[model samples]
Target: MSGQQHILEFRFLAEPTDVNFGGKVHGGAVLKWIDQAAYACAVAWSGKYCVTAAMGGIQFVAPILIGDFVQVRCRLVHTGTSSMNLIVDVRARDLKAVRDRLATQCVLTFVALDAPDGKPTPVPKWIPESEEDMALARYAEKVMEVHRRIDQEVSDLRPAGQDH
Candidate 1:
């Protein structure tokens, strides 16, 4: 509907040079596409430059091949004071295929930034409007919780007084 809405879709054909040595589309290319889509969605919602803060749960479900039509769908699932949690799914289908198959999925966090200073700025709050939206929002919360625990564990492992 509107650019400020929760969803953004990016569709394009997989190019010949996008493949890896195995003849399948490279994961790096797919990741780049996913990041681009997420960035677009974040900028649209925040109306400010947004930088990726973190990415998690990256799953490569299937391989993408050259000549397949690729689609990257990014959806805003939750929001913190200055961050937006987005779910990005990449799907691809051959020319004759009727439906696309999931190729990759990940959750990305982007933080809106204030210009000049490049400090984190508050983003517009996101409200779930449907059951699906609510479920996704809850899922994002769980993902963030796991990330927090992992971060804490990593921090605890560091030598005392060595923050770097």
Candidate 2:
């Protein structure tokens, strides 16, 4: 909405189907919304088809109830040669409420692909302008570092000459 292609926001009413047996919106449903929002932001920023590469730091802080207003905000925080990292925040508010409560938050990585060959393709670089943008980019970098460490640990655990 601000002419920034790197950001996307979705707002919708929570449906009864989104509720779990506990009378709140289910975790899986919230994750689906996060993915959808992140995917849209990735595609918008890259101007190409994008696939989710990884998801990390998922935190479900609160539960969304049926009939609440749900909003998912996704913004590009960092970009690699072919991958874009997005910070997705999901919030919910009762219809009569004045403020929204954070329901979930996570970082998602998406990779752009060439249309013909389906290979990873470079996406346009994003430059941070404001302090908030810079901070978010730094947070994304930290998340990537964590992912790298985990991957390395997993690889180290695997038997030599065996790639799984």
Candidate 3:
């Protein structure tokens, strides 16, 4: 996505400590990178402290071996009253192959927090100005639909009077 608003790009080199015995980066390590990237994007868009509410559709597509340089590109996909959806794409640069491959991808939901009580706080509405931005918003809407269905199924399975 090309725009002035999409603002979080972080780069780091994968060291031996970030990898596992199989010579690939650990799954948890990649998850941590995703969370950090998403958090930065949310905070930049909301201009407030944000905490992770949920994460969805995290899939590791390829292995990132040690010594590879990884880059995480994060963008704000949508915003609610107090929550925002951030999509992060992780890519590993293979110096040997002279190419970069997508390692993992995830959509992270974050809620702005009030400093006083750490409760949810209001955030600005996300206005999509371009076609690319609108496309991301549409994708986020689909993710929300899936989340809604999961919540509904869980509620339907609850015992009577214990529906919470």
TM-score of each predicted structure versus truth: 0.92, 0.92, 0.87
What is the C-alpha local distance difference test score of each model? Answer: 0.91, 0.91, 0.85
TM-score of 3: 0.87
lDDT of 2: 0.91
Give the C-alpha miss distance for residue 123 in model 2, angstroms: 0.6
lDDT of 3 by residue, 68-143 (tens): 8899999887888999988889999877778799999978899999888988988878888799989988887788
lDDT of 2 by residue, 1-164 (tens): 21259889999999999999999998999999999999999988998899999888889999999999999999999988999999999999999989999999989999999999999999998989899999999998888789878988999999999896
Give the per-residue lDDT of model 1 (tens digit) for 76-125. Answer: 99999999999999999998989989999988999999999999998889
Better of 2 and 3 by lDDT: 2
**Best lDDT among the predictions, by candidate number:** 2
Number of clashes in model 2?
0
Error of 2 at 81 (Å): 1.1
Better of 1 and 3 by TM-score: 1
lDDT of 3: 0.85
- On the 0 to 100 scale, the lDDT of residue 44 in model 3 is 78
